[model samples]
Target: MQKIKLFTDSTSDLSKQLLNEHRIDVVPLSVVFADKAFKDGQEINTEKMYNIIDENGKLPKTSAPSPQDFIDAFKPYIDDGYEIIYIGLSSDLSVTCQNASLASQSLDGKVHVVDSKNLSTGIGLLVLKAADFINEGFSSEEVAQKVRNLVEKVETEFVINTLEYLHKGGRCSGVQNFVGNMLKIRPVVKVVDGGMILAQKTRGKRKKALKTLLKNALKNKKEITEDRIFVTHSMDSEGAEYLKAELEKEVKGQVIITDAGCVISSHCGPKTVGILYIKK
Candidate 1:
């Protein structure tokens, strides 16, 4: 059996510790500002990105990594006689998956790209599972198939503290942004069928919105797998901790807190917290 190697993009929002521990390779997406471009999680981080956004009052443009980037990342492993499997962010959200596919075509079947159909820790959850299957002696093909099957089982939902970022990113209209901020309306964005949708809107403070998100997640606890869950945030340690503490009381899984990368934070903005897990 050929050795299996795992690859993922920076949008996975996985912590460096997890990436190093699992031996995962990451191709970083670009976070472009009006003045310069930085590699997500490398040249820039969440706090610095947030500060730039605040200073400029503009949301940075995030671009998917080029096909060449994936090719370069996979070439070293292929030369070492390993089959590569790359799990990327949702194709619906970014062209990162498509670029990976293009890169795979040039690798002579040594690479398999899986569209996570989700983002952030939603992708992280699947990548970790792929690592587990590979460690259990599953063939590269088997590991890819097993991870793809779990794509739809992943549940991802986040609460936005403000609509300013959404408006700047063209996801929300200026009027909606104005009204939402005026009313302190927070929307819970959920990943459904490979796209993000407004799952629910809560009118009140951010605390109320976070509680609503927690309630929605717990209501489906029976279906949630007790393996591992991720609490990913963009400078929202308070919200992440609240969700983690509440979730730990109900679910047996380990709740991990991770900082969102620049790519994710550019769109979601600061104080955006998401809970991601695979369902049984």
Candidate 2:
């Protein structure tokens, strides 16, 4: 029997410590600024990405890793007689999973790709479960199937501090974006069916925005798996900490906080925060 190797993309928003501790690998996407590119978790880290966004007052563009990048990552584990299971970001949101699927075709069945249908710690939670299964001596195929089943149950929600990033990135209309910025209308968005959509809106300062986010996103906190909660942020430590404190009262378990990697940071911008958990 061969050992199972776990992998995921940088959009998983998993910390390097977590990845290294689990021996999980990541294929990084590109965050481009002014025609210059940097790998998500490598060349450009989360803090640097956020600082650049703050300095330029513009959201950087994010590109999926090439199929070749997946190939490069998959080959080593395969050559070492290991079966690879790569859990990737949502296909509806990014091309990362699509490229990973394409790259697996060349690995002669040694590599298996799981389209996580999620992002941030949404993908990270699935990857971590797969790793647990592997550690428990489950086969790669079994681990993949179990993790895939958890996809629809994962919940991810975020509130943007400002509409400036979304406006600059063309995610929202300039007129509404301008007005929202003027009036300080922070938006609360949720991930549904692998796509991000506006679930609600809140006006006023950061505290009010966060209050709305917690209420809207965690309305069904009873449904969340009691084992763990993930709070991922883009250089928003204060917000993340506040969220963590709030979430701790809802779920009696571990709440891990991680920085959103470059790909997620590029779109989410600085001072954005979110919570992820699996539904029971």
Candidate 3:
């Protein structure tokens, strides 16, 4: 039987170690600062992006890879006679999936593109699920079907330290209530149906927001997968440690922690944290 290949974009925010462990192929998105552009994980890093955003008072423009980029990444695996599955970020969130879809046309039916309908570690969870199925000797088609089934099962949400980034990035204009009041209103944002939606709102205090995050998780703990849980943060290493400890106490499996990548940080800003997992 031919080997199965798994691919994801940098927006998945998977760590280099995790990607290497699974031998997962990754296509990078671009974070552009004016005329200059840098690869998501290669040329520029999350820290540099955050520093630039701080100094510039604006978020850098993020762009998905062109079809050519995905095409190049797909060709090698397809040439190796291995079936290809490219799991992508949310369609509503970015054009990454569309690019992957366009690239799929170059290959035969051997290449499959899946819309994770998620971003950050939400996308990572689906990729891991596909890897799990492949490890069980499942075919590419089987992996695709299994991952798609797990897509909705994977729940994703985050709490930003402030909504300033959203306002500065011109994303949350409609939520003018949180404009100047972001310091006092910490909204728990969730990924639902391929878009970011406000899940809950708490006090301006970071601790309050964290409690809300943990509260929601505990309420829904029965539905979350017990195998692995991801605690993803944009900086906030200390907060990630606390969140990971709290999560490990409630979860049966290992708690994997990762810092969100530059592309993701550009939108959410710094000091943001999220807990991601698949449903049981």
Report the error of model 3 at residue 161, Å. Answer: 0.6
Q: Sorted by lDDT, highest first, which candidate order results?
A: 1, 3, 2
Model 2, 1-280: lDDT tens digits are 6588888988898888989999999888889998999988889897887788778877788889898988998898889888889998899988888898889889998878888888889999998888888888888889988998999998889888888777787888999988998888888888899989998788888899888877855787878887778988888899999989998887776899998887776776678888888888
Candidate topping TM-score: 1
Q: How close is every model to the real structure, measured as TM-score? A: 0.98, 0.95, 0.96
The CA lDDT of each predicted structure is 0.92, 0.85, 0.87
Model 3 spans > 4 angstroms off: 173-183
| Collision pairs in model 2 | none
For model 1, residues 1-280, the per-residue Cα lDDT tens digits are 6698999999999999999999998999989998688999889998998888889888889888999998999998999999999999999999999999999999999998899999999999999999999999999999999999999999999998989999999998999999999999999999998998999999998899999989989989999998899999999898899899999999999899999998888888889999999999
lDDT of model 3, residue 58? 69
Considering every candidate listed, which one attains the maximal lDDT?
Answer: 1
Tell me which of candidates 2 and 3 scores higher on lDDT.
3
Clashing pairs in 3: 184-204
Report the lDDT of model 2 for residue 123.
Answer: 92
lDDT of 3 by residue, 22-123 (tens): 999889999999999999998999998888877887688989999999888888888888888999989998999998898888788888889999999999
**What is candidate 3's CA lDDT for residue 159?**
89
Cα-based lDDT at residue 247, candidate 3: 82
